[model samples]
Target: MYESCFYFVINMSISGSLVILSLLIVRQIKIISRRLLYVLWFVALIRMLLPFAISSSISVFNYLSGLIKKLIPVGNLFDANFTVSNYFNAALSYSPMEYKTQRFEHVFGISSCIWLMGVCISLIAIIVIYCSTIRQYKNAVHLKDNIYEDKTVLSPFLLGIRNPKIILPIGLDISSSQAVHIIAHEKTHMQRMDNLWRIIGLGTVCIHWFNPIAWFGFFFFLNDMELSCDEATTKTYGFAKKKEYAEALFSIAGNRQNKNLIHASFGKSDTKSRVLNVLAYKRLSVFGIAASIAFLLLVAIMLLTNPKV
Candidate 1:
């Protein structure tokens, strides 16, 4: 059990870094649908969370693991008992007595305890932030059905998990058309259950807070989510309103503050890129759609499956 926990964290860290590098490559391709990218990130999130994977002959992990073993004389790269502390101790020729007790297995047990401490700290921080955000909006004024006007927030966002409510800023000079677009966008987020995905991503962060790539990948994943929502809203409202939607983003983004963390806001942090994606949005050709599906399947197989060595 001790070894299992350590290896799970190691695998998650490696897989997350791979996902980040892969997304960086994929983002450079302009012809692909943004919606497809959203799905790909979700798969990456699941990849980071799971420990066991299906084995394939052509798996990327198999080849990469073999190359890593050849390049670095790390102690038993695939050993169940191998851990970060052991790897460092072997590489550096030094061991901290506190961690490396009399018994060898105690090293891993100590390392696992440290890793778990980080996870607990991350989860507690998230809970505190979530509770604080909820408390700030406790006095929000109810507008029309299910919508509330709050002076605390700059942009409109959806709050709550079970009975999710839409909260818009109090003073927005929105035309009826723009109002429709904004409402539609937030509604699409709820319809697609994006908040649940956000929570899952948060869980991933809490578990792997030590990995910088995990943090960046999760942020990029959230951006793709908003872009995907933009794609859906445009599909429903017609692509002619793309400019209007983009303008709405810019206007709201100017007022956006870095206060809330729990709510899914209408305006994203990377508003410029999102608006550009909206303007650059094109209908996927039949071949493009098919190719997109094939590419996603390929990525899923490569990242989620391990090669049987």
Candidate 2:
């Protein structure tokens, strides 16, 4: 169990590096489609959850490993005679095997216990918060099909995984253009199944609670999700409707409350970034779309694969 925990920590460190690389790529490709940016973050999320990948010579990790070797002596980090593969294999075997040192074993056991404790606390906290939020909104008035009006919530958000309810706050004119845009935005989140994705992202963070980079990646992923949804909702709208969409977004942000991780709130994330993306929305040409797809594939190949052995 201790060996398994150590292996998990190593995998998470690799995934954190992937998150950093993805963030750099996102920064460079800010002009690309927001949906594509969301996809890039999704790739990072997959890395966080999965432990293995196919090795490739072109992988960014390959170069990074070389750079590290040049900057720091590998022998200083570990015993020159130590065999990593033998140690790892022995750790996995069920039969009793000789350990190099009792101190190492004791340290690993203690660390594993600490990691497990953190996981339990993080998971329990998330569940408690989610259940409390559900209880708070249990009596939400059903205004229409799959839509509810909750006086407590200050912004519109989608809740539930199987049967998501779009919750709107009180005093909003449903007939007005801003209301139309807000509803459309929530519907877009449902269409994209963003609530499910948000849950998965949060779960990943809970498991990797000790890693600050994982938390950063999770929040960035949420921001990207909102930006993509905004792009999708306003894709067909003209300048005036896009303006109205931005206005609706701004209104929601101003009155935003309930920034829960479990629910996909319309105005919960980086509102400044979302509003800017909405106002700068432009239809991509065929060539531009093709380029974006190619870029996505490139990112998948470069970052998703393991360093060549």
Q: Which candidate is the best by TM-score?
A: 2
**Clash count in backbone of candidate 1:** 0
Against the true structure, whose lDDT is highest?
2
Clashing pairs in model 2, backbone N/Cα/C closer than 3 A: none
TM-score (C-alpha) between model 1 and the true structure? 0.83
| Displacement of the residue 135 alpha carbon in candidate 1, Å | 2.8
Worst 10 residues of 1 by lDDT: 81-90
Candidate 1 structure lDDT: 0.73
CA shift of 269, model 1, Å: 2.2
Model 2 error, position 118 (Å): 0.7
- lDDT for each candidate structure: 0.73, 0.75
| Regions more than 4 Å wrong, model 1 | 1-3, 65-107, 173-175, 236-239
TM-scores, one per candidate: 0.83, 0.86
Stretches off by above 4 angstroms in model 2 are: 66-100
